[model samples]
Target chain A: MTLSSGTVAPGAPTRTATGSVTVRALRLLESFTAERPELSLSELARRSGTPLSTVHRLVGDLMEWGALERDPSTGRIRVGLRLWEVASLAPRALSLREAAIPVLEDVAAVTHENVQLGVREGDEVVFVERIRGRRSVRLLTRVGGRFALPPTGIGLALLAHAPADVQERVCAGPLRRFTPYTVTDPVRLRAMLAEVRRSGVAVSDRQVTDDAVSVAAPVFDRSRAIRAAVSVVVEADTGRPAQLTPLVRAAALSIGRALG
Target chain B: MTLSSGTVAPGAPTRTATGSVTVRALRLLESFTAERPELSLSELARRSGTPLSTVHRLVGDLMEWGALERDPSTGRIRVGLRLWEVASLAPRALSLREAAIPVLEDVAAVTHENVQLGVREGDEVVFVERIRGRRSVRLLTRVGGRFALPPTGIGLALLAHAPADVQERVCAGPLRRFTPYTVTDPVRLRAMLAEVRRSGVAVSDRQVTDDAVSVAAPVFDRSRAIRAAVSVVVEADTGRPAQLTPLVRAAALSIGRALG
Candidate 1:
């Protein structure tokens, strides 16, 4: 079974006929986003589109389970540490991070730049782990944050190895542009994908941000299946993408080996 | 409403009287632990004590929502990345990690050891972020992993600043010894706590592990509240705890400032 396309499916609790209560509770959680991490009880009810009574009951249960915590001062609620602890057991994120950290440390030691490990999740890249270098350029990306697959080096690297249908779907346009350098044209993006495939490396130059450039390489598991990508982001003016390419690729390979 | 000191409350779904379906479903998730990340359908049913049919229905909803994912080969289920993404927004974990990463990177660069940032949760310490140096000693702890409050440097640092009631409860005994060098005596532990409070640092030498030594310091938020703790673990016999002490303390302070 798969969730409907929208966050709250038709016949969801918001309407007269309620769907599963589990679905309604999960929708309440989904309402809390990066921009709005905390929400008052009424705000949660409004955002989740559930009635206040239902929201209060569900929130009470969630709070008791430690999946939600109330602020001492404001009476607002946020996701709880216990929830994070349980979620940390997710193999896709934490397991991969555990395997890749040592290799990432090596890459960071050499380049002293932001190092990231990401896997393709649908059409987006979800950063599983990131090692911020001591003197590297600042990045907007956060661990577990999502970004478009067309504009990031790790995204391009993962996209270059993605299935043909997925590649086609992503290249069919409506691509969001972060900067002028971001390749929004499907035709241009297709060409870049081919080049990345050929070279086994992807360079995203000032695509996500004006001052940052990232070099990324795909990682293969024991079966030689492309599993993930690793990248190193540097200041655009540094102009050392060429020098950093091998280092990033080597780290990716080492991580793949460790995953075995 | 507080949960009655166990994973599930007294009126939880386990009894003949069923609780909310949503709470029951969430309990299925709480059943997953570090020791058992993956669970077969039957195992999930048994662990959660939900009827097999009910488990089937709830698991379907969870899987559809991407809160639970099935392992391809074994058909076992595990926590999903989507859930981790949502949980990552928990301010107690991600926000603190975001502020601490840079300072941690600096500590890693200088000491090249395992640097950790942790917050107290109950009587234990939950490591929010950990940067393992390239040549650091192998550690039993992982990011999001928990350890006893008496043996780990971060744990000691956090425990030192805990409320008097919490401290008394913890020091009241049954302290598990990880190694022979571990401090199991409450009186000695209290003295060590006093020293940590006075010096704003905690050192655990060959306590949790036989071959490792760790130095830790308390982190103060803008309110001057002891919000977290930072630590660096190195191999024993290296005898540089004194040298690493200041570096870890400084990083903790820097992270606290960044948190503001």
Candidate 2:
């Protein structure tokens, strides 16, 4: 699930002249993923593209500051608690997650669907939080994971509110096809985005997967800027996208009010 | 709640050479605390001790990178979700919290007491997560908050497993007193820790507050190193500490199994 070493995370600044090894160190941390949470020192060095000694020194600094810690027996490194405590204060994610959870719980309780919250990050939509219902359909998204902005219902809702260039660039995407129903053609995708803007809700039926259909709506901040999207995924067959729109939109509005 | 201006975060490194104006900029970010989650540029500069112009420039960098964001209505600085995303990968707190929550909940359900999960951080105990029982006595602790690692039952549980030197250092401390029942004498505290180690559980009878007593036990990793402590806080006079030990220890064991 993790990108290979030497693959710098997106938004990583061009590392040319600034005596900013710090940002690069942060980008190095971006290499650790949920699938590969623990990494050996050599693996970290290799993955971060830093010299072993440099990695060792930086790791030492991080450990000292409680940003990183090694498993005493395995000698593998894991993310430390201090980082999490600081992160818990991230207003955009934490506040949104806190507001969205109860509504997502309500959504899941009613539809027994997969409930999700996503926000725009550059050309992608990052799933900030997710809650699965007991008998929900399968989903590929994970909390804190990112996906291209034109594929899913939540993605379309976010894309509909993005700047013209962002939307244009997404429309120009070499869109990855997950199923036969995915709208790979830029023209059709643009129309879908426009319809999302028109109806104030987005329907992504079996676009992400063959057996799932998601209904999503935009969540706005005080300026009515689309800050987030809320969605519920139910079984593809007998899926009532229109019927679920009001429920999804209501959840989005509640979250928007909470955010405001 | 926040210290000096643009203090560097865990991953940030500042240089004395560039007189790295960025260091002061980072301090502006630190100016926002859990209590005061937002700040204006003046507040940022004043708190961080940076020049107003430098604060402006550094704030721009952080705002650009989404490490800090402005409230749409108030234009106040708040911690950004991007920083939260980067820091959420920290596995230490969340992993322990996830493993411990169900067991903590179970303990709280059975005892109607506040159940908490905490790990040792420096000479303090930082609460990773907590489940407040309906009938539990109020505690001074909050999730993601820190306290001295001596008086609380969870603290003793973790401290009991700490190295001899670490325990000695804690005993050497100017221990803060919460109530008359709090053990202030080092000799008595040392004896308490010894008994905790021997019994594999720790009990604090009204150590933190006049009304609350707590029972706690250690959560071990597969390597048998104490990773976290789980505890239940109840009314001091309602239950015997010895009787609560088995229940707290059982919860800790449940968490240990979950971690494994």
Candidate 3:
């Protein structure tokens, strides 16, 4: 998902001509999104709102440190492998994905469905891992992409276990609807979340897309606190969410145990 | 692997007390490793060689930009999910991994061996993806980790196709020996690389570990230039590198075609 440039911390220093160099460099990085994975120097300067000369110097530093790379043939800039190496140490994403992959693989192997893992990031659900089954329906999600808390099963599971304020904030929202089956009513969404919390499983039927359904369950850490969520998504026409509920729950439990 | 702080550009500014703020911030990120994924602010300062006051301010800015995260329970800092999300767009790592995964999975499924993908970064080979089969031999390699260019099969494949300068530099010596079978002699390593180039595959028999053997082949891009390498590692005792060579080569070819 595209990072919002306005997501600055409250009370943080304002972005101005003399703003923090670190922030400006990071904004340059944020400018490279899924849609525009590569950009020229001028594009980077424009997108990051930095002076051309400053962007040039910052880009050089970033390239040297391996935070960004220059394409040899095209001379465009993209995220560097070294940055990915450091970011791989992020416990919230790759570490969690490592812990859940074996179990996710098992679910995908048995059900031949799209298996996913996600964690709450603010009011959004950041998908950390996804295994596309050989026979699974196409999903709109991708690894490292974010979705609203009430849209997909994995998001629902995480939202159900989230703090009250987060739940309320989502419940009282101008929720984006993807399909006719998507639950947009605050009352209905609350009931769905409550059911997820009570049953330890969330069934999202065609909520994200008209052709897909997902069954999800929350994963816990050693402290018995919900840390992430796992789900198995399948084609809506012939999907059996009820039958897959126990499998998804079992995978979630196994992932939680692995995390411990 | 621990990133060497000395890997700065040839003419980059010296990291003095009044050096670039962006460099200091990046060094702070470099302080976190696979082994020490979490660190206190003071530890970060110590590891990054930045003043505590500067580190504190940098850490604040980093945390605000979602480049770093503070664990709520431990109050320790680590790489943030936002950084990982941005890094996931790195074409050399995750994007290549995405293109190679289907073929890698096929190799893993058919051989029930350890599948790995790696790309050259300077003189080192950085592993971007790895899939351990259920019945595969244990491996020392991890995703996002770096290895020397002469020992592992994937490394050899990349090294064989590397630029002349890179190949010669690696062949110059001081190779770390991981096992009795690891090729330490520059002459022998050069011969191995030659064979890899001629045969379109590299075999590492008990190189990194005494009990495992790996067969690797180089993956090419649309321009027919070697971009990465793919390998399947198996138990040394029962492994048939000769039998697996063609399979690894085919997987590599499939991955390269996918990259097109």
Give the per-residue lDDT digits (tens) of candidate 2, residues B221-255.
Answer: 77788889988887877766677888888888889
The root-mean-square deviation over C-alpha atoms between each candidate and the true structure, in angstroms, is 4.1, 6.7, 4.3
Best by lDDT: 3
Poorest stretch of ten by lDDT in candidate 1 chain B: B7-16
Where does candidate 2 chain B have its weakest 10-residue lDDT segment?
Answer: B1-10
The fnat score for candidate 3 comes to: 0.59
| Residue lDDT tens for model 1, A1-260 | 35233433444332334446566677678889888989988899899888886677677768766788875545689998888998999988877887898888778777778899999888999998887776689787888789999999999999999999999999997999888898989999999999999998999999999999999999988887787899999999975888998888888889999887
Task: Pick the TM-score winner.
Answer: 3
Return the candidate ranking by TM-score, descending: 3, 1, 2
Task: Give all TM-scores, in the order shown.
Answer: 0.89, 0.79, 0.93
Q: Tell me how far the alpha carbon of residue B77 in candidate 1 is from the true structure, in angstroms, after superposition.
A: 1.6
Q: Relative to the true structure, how large is the alpha-carbon lDDT of every model?
A: 0.84, 0.76, 0.86
Candidate 1 — which residues are off by over 4 angstroms? A1-18, B1-19
By the lDDT metric, which is better: model 1 or model 3?
Answer: 3
lDDT of 1 by residue, B1-260 (tens): 44334434345332334556666777899788878999987899899887886677778778767889886556689998888999999988977888888788778778878889899988899998887776699788877788889999999999999999989999997899999999999999999999999998999999999999999999988887888899999989874888887788788889999998
- lDDT of model 3 at residue B182? 92
